[model samples]
Target: MYTSQQPAIAVDGQNRIHIVWSSYLPIGNALYNIFYRMRNSNGLWGPIETLSVFPNSYHNYNPRVAIDSEGNVHVVWEAYLANEYYPHIAHRVKTNRGWSEVVVLQSSYRRENPSCAVDKFNNLQVVVTTNEIGPSYDIVRFVRTPEGNWEGPDTVVHFNTGSRYFPEIVATPDGNLHLFRRDFGHYTNYCYRIYYKRYKILNYVILE
Candidate 1:
């Protein structure tokens, strides 16, 4: 069982379970790292693996996981790159050999609260909030095509002139996408609502 402020879990067809979480360890002052654990089909959990061992002063959080049809595990999280003021999205994959190298998805944006899902075609869809510019926020999506290529500079899912945060996304059984986010209205000071929207991807067309 993994415990942290942010946690994510995914299961494969073989009943192999994977979990990722953020843990803060005090080296000199305080620092955090993303640790991972897995449960085999026999119900035995492997030892915790330190996925990121950054410096003791940096902060790491908001870990998410997704598993594809071939049983490859993908993980994404928010972390501060060396000599950077803002956090960026970092990704990794698990294979029969071992965990692959950490890949940085977005370097310029202050990204956080990332969640990922794999489509039926084994394409990876990731959604996260960014605060690279001003007070408002934007939701960005990255799709890894089945051809083993990462598509685009990240499509904008939602953009708000007002404040927005905490996005959750899921791929539906019907090949559609569902997204939920916290919305803060501008005029109605007393009205804060959570909004839900559905997106359909048919013939490679993303329809709202």
Candidate 2:
């Protein structure tokens, strides 16, 4: 019954709507995978496409989609690979030529809840919750340069005893970034808190 969960949507300059979500199929080689579907500018719906690779042994979840300035569709999700100790952040991009191969942005740590956004310069930025540094989960950022180079898995927020999750990021026309996420165990009186962070883009790079 987990056929659809955590859906993400984006629209390109041509007015085409792109959507991605995680699905669970008990009979498949992999129990969970990410699926994509789009609505054309003419309002016609296209066939649903499966976007995850290595589906034979991977369970994918928490997908996030973004559309760059040049119309490339970027998708990121969390996946549990076979025999792996923790989940990884996987990414894929669909351009004029079609979808590229699935790339793992982070595999060394326990990561989940990936979020992504494209700046005005066409650089892609992704964020996920990871516990690589410690037992407490931290919000980590990864930037894919406009020239197609990957930048980081830098930890942006940390706490000795708390965790962060469900990060969301947005890039504005002026090249500014806005990030928000849920915080847990940070305060004794409250169960959770919503945190906000702002960043600036310089030469297609995110500044601290």
Q: Give the number of the best model, judged by TM-score.
A: 2
Candidate 1 Cα errors over 4 Å, as ranges: 1-3, 26-30, 54-57, 132-135, 146-148, 187-190, 203-205
lDDT of each: 0.74, 0.84
Q: Cα lDDT for residue 157, model 1?
A: 52
TM-score of 1: 0.85
Candidate 1 residue pairs in backbone clash: none
Q: lDDT tens digits, residues 157-184, model 1? A: 5454665668888886688888887767
Would you list the clashing residue pairs of candidate 2?
A: none
- For model 2 the local lDDT of residue 47 reads 97
Query: Per-residue alpha-carbon lDDT of model 2 for 63-119, expressed as tens digits?
Result: 999998888899999988776758998888998899988887646778898889998
How close is every model to the real structure, measured as TM-score?
A: 0.85, 0.91
Compared with the true structure, the alpha-carbon lDDT of candidate 2 equals 0.84
Tell how far residue 204 is off in model 2, in angstroms: 5.5
Looking at model 1, report the run of 10 residues with the lowest lDDT sum. Answer: 152-161
Distance from true location, Cα of 174 in model 2, Å: 1.2
